[model samples]
Target: MIAQQAIGLIAISALASACAPELYKRDGIHPAHIQKRQHIPNVVEDTRGWTFDQSEEWNTQSPGWGACFAGTQQSPIDLQTSWGFAKSSPPVFNYPKALKGPLNNWDFGPQFTLAAVADDNTTEASIQFSHDGVEETAYFRSWHTHAPAEHTIDGYAPRAELHYVHYDDAGIPRAVVGFFVDQATAENPSSGSAFYKQLESLALPDIFNNQTIPEITLDLNLAISEVNDYKNFWTYKGSLTTPPCLEGLRWFVSKDIIYLSDAQLESLLKVSTFGARPVHRVWGHQVNA
Candidate 1:
């Protein structure tokens, strides 16, 4: 009987191990959470009335659910690569060498805002692209990360997603580039592995709070170029994935998948919840690749 009990214990241990993140099997990354050994003062947990936990309720619970559920161009629609066409050209990024800002945890997720004017008052980092034969430029506003990816590629969601928000000359959010992120395991070390590690190391504020971090070590040029080839992406007319779910925003979801390392992701999960809203309908919007 004692021998049979030992075998049962082994089986339970095997099952538990199998459920761990597949990347942790070989990468012995350090635990990234703040412990009793380290602490911050004057920091508070971020708060929010809307959460991705109850995404279905977003249509009614959120104050601006009218557009979120009833709108025709709601964002984060599944992108089909086969829809590629020659009618549009990919946007050209004028991203600078570096950026400095505070990392804040808003209701959606951890947002690295573009400070001072936030996403509205700056054209420092911008993207230039042609849509419908009209050339336009959109300035870099801010960027954020979400888990399980907000946009799915051909109906399959990736491990994570990164969004770079851009505003027009009038300070209106006119463009956003969405990149799917995969886990960088030892078997497949991703181009974004180093970049993401740098971001994960910074001391961060709790959810809904903001922490002033020093000038970041990230290089905007490398961050995007390394992750994507910059030529292959899908463009469409859509709305905001968050509250108010405003419509008429320009979207460029990339075909290239960026890879975030295990350590980087574990650190993020410590501060963020699943942020991908449920996929919306295309409503006849021409998704040009």
Candidate 2:
């Protein structure tokens, strides 16, 4: 059955490409009233060099992210623990504590990408939260990671950063919840984030191309528990922190630090050693760390 399904999907993908290129873009994306991404260059085959390490050269080398050097409200800012107002009403996440069976995991060369591909829907997962005057539900369209993290805590960067990218109903990026992971001590080696473990296992092979794992079960709630602490988190307005540097994104940087063992960290580094963007300057931005 699995083989038949895979064959059917390949056939459908081929037919879709051969029949109508306008219906679905050549990159397998369905067109809609999405944000202006035409400025962003194609990255399907250019993953090897266009990484976070070379983000500084994105302007001259990778012209796709020239705005990254010019944008003011960029992301992955250093969370100043002493800043921002402490509100009583914190954000919440309505995610499953555990997933039933296997879920699809994709290897987009530079990093692992996961979404609800089986359903043919744009959103793979989603969660809800309300803070300040902002009451919005975010759908999980896709997720990727940054080794050595993006946002810093009081000037300290974590071992790795898990970015759960969410979008609104209008197909605009609404929020990105960043979970910071630190190296675990001997006393506490496991942080109970099965999602991270699954990602590590799937990406440990380090095949730099388009690949997919059809079935991988994980505890979505445990993953959230690994990072989500209802009381301790920082929220701010920022950009995607990547190419094009599109602004107007909502950022939720978790204050609670999750722990990853040495082996797990090693697995992550093996997959994408240079997938972290340099820390961009943050000036006049609001952050409650």
Best by lDDT: 1
Residue range 191-274, candidate 1, lDDT tens digits: 456556667667765453333353454556655675555677788888777654667778888787777666666677677667
For model 2, residues 249-278, the per-residue Cα lDDT tens digits are 777777777787777766666665444566
- Choose the strongest candidate by TM-score: 1
Cα lDDT listed for each candidate: 0.63, 0.55
TM-score of model 2 vs. true structure: 0.70
Cα error, candidate 1, residue 193 (Å): 1.8
Which residues of candidate 2, in runs, are more than 4 Å off?
1-49, 61-66, 84-88, 97-124, 186-194, 199-210
Candidate 2: residue pairs that collide: 103-216, 116-124, 125-140
Model 1 weakest lDDT span, ten residues long: 18-27
Q: How large an RMSD does model 1 have?
A: 16.1
